[model samples]
Target: MEAPRLTTKTFHLQHGTSVYELHLKRLEADRVQLRGTKISNPEGSKALDEVEAHVQQRGNEIVLKTANGPHRAIAVRTARGVWVSLGERTAFFEFARKDVDAVSTQPVKTEIHAPMTGKIVDVRVKPNQKVGLGDILVIMEAMKMEFKLEAPMEALIESVGCEKGQLVDLGQLLVQLKTLDNKKA
Candidate 1:
């Protein structure tokens, strides 16, 4: 048996519609540094910072000591992607390619995007379905908690962007709806 080798890797972390480019490398025994740059800010104003951290592995739990404080997390890697849980919250991430994801620069008012990364447990409405404000449109699961996302206003669902069991990123569009009064030709 030999000590595990550490190398540098970069990733694009998607939080909602925002994508962050992160560089990770191990510096010393159980110590590492993380640097991140925002790559999806259409505003063109991006600032990246570096953070020093220490990690302690205890069986299935890992504790990260950062400048802020010590936080515990659990990481699971599967064929689909990597799932990480911190406290009661969890986030899912996938590897990013050099080709940045193409996102619309226009502001969207009728689109409902995931507020956090999670698995789509269920979709309550279908395309063209009429829904009132407060109607639950989708249910997602993260860190053993289920969240029901509702309609912000009465609208007819123009399209559904997510299916059951789909992994969605934060700010990733899940549903597009139009006000009932906005009739399309």
Candidate 2:
């Protein structure tokens, strides 16, 4: 996790039922330290390992130092969490530490919205079709630029809301997806 400015803070990061306490401290500019411990270890259970890492920001890029090595990454402070990019992999972490407290608008979302004002050039998937990550589900064109919105995660296509030549506005619902858990519901 990273921010444009520096400060000392504590946070609770949660993904599913796992909650972790994250403490951030800056010893100096370009040197930020991290300490993490799980906050929900049950009695008589094996303890969750405590983790420590360092973050060094250089201009627009960041270097994450762990026991492994210094790895290059980009960390962007988002509305609800930090968006960290390590090469082709990216992850979003949710927290409301210190002055930033943005609740995630969707708890269990499966809908895909229009990323921008665009004309739907094609709708590729039908209901019940299974798609994996990075699979393109829709093709859009806006301002003469083409965009392929892909599956954010692996799921079954529940429905499609647009068709060829359909014009959609920003945030318009374009497709609905359902994972295995939702199917069991």
Candidate 3:
């Protein structure tokens, strides 16, 4: 069977202080092509040259086949962005909505959204529960992979918008929290 064609989408990915514009399209069910250009280059380092690579997903990992050879990485999609780990390096890349020309910075720190369409395997917090930064608030499963949504800051849960075993769409607000320091929710 032939794989379906996927539309190309542009995303702004940040690593350290540098940002890149990446256009991605699926060439096959397991093969993707990405073209990237460095959009912001700070001092003390060189800009990334234009790059094109064929990518494939292997379970929770991804392999990028470039002219320089193959590289492996793992990517986790979170409520605020995608966290990509390569070798000894990991970077959080805040994503622009697919096909959109704008960038999404960190959402209000008190809200936790569903990172992808998935079934909620666990809801780990309740209203009034205090959670610290990095606490796991929700556990979801998508495409047979589990994602642990962590607290972005110390906060008290204001509400739970989902339950265990419930399916949620990408970007759905799953939890609302009020910061512990008297900031806004």
Best by TM-score: 1
Local distance difference test scores for all models: 0.81, 0.74, 0.78
In the range 57-119, model 2's lDDT, one tens digit per residue, is 876578877787788998887677677789788776676343222222223568999999989
Summarize candidate 1's per-residue lDDT along 93-168 as a digit string, tens digits: 7655545545324233688999899999999999989999999999999888999999989989999999999999
Off by over 4 Å in 2: 1-108
TM-score of 2: 0.44
Ranking of models by TM-score = 1, 3, 2
- Model 3 segments beyond 4 Å from truth? 1-108
Residue pairs in candidate 1 whose N, alpha carbon or C atoms collide under 3 angstroms: 16-170, 16-171
Question: Model 3: how far is 111 from its true place, Å?
Answer: 1.3
- For 1-185, candidate 3 gives per-residue lDDT tens digits of 87578878777766655566777777766666676665432232234455567777877698988889889999888777788899899888885444322322333557789989999999999999999989999999999999999998888898999999999999999999887778442
> Of 2 and 3, which scores higher on lDDT?
3
What's each prediction's clash count?
Answer: 2, 0, 0
Model 3 CA lDDT for position 161: 99
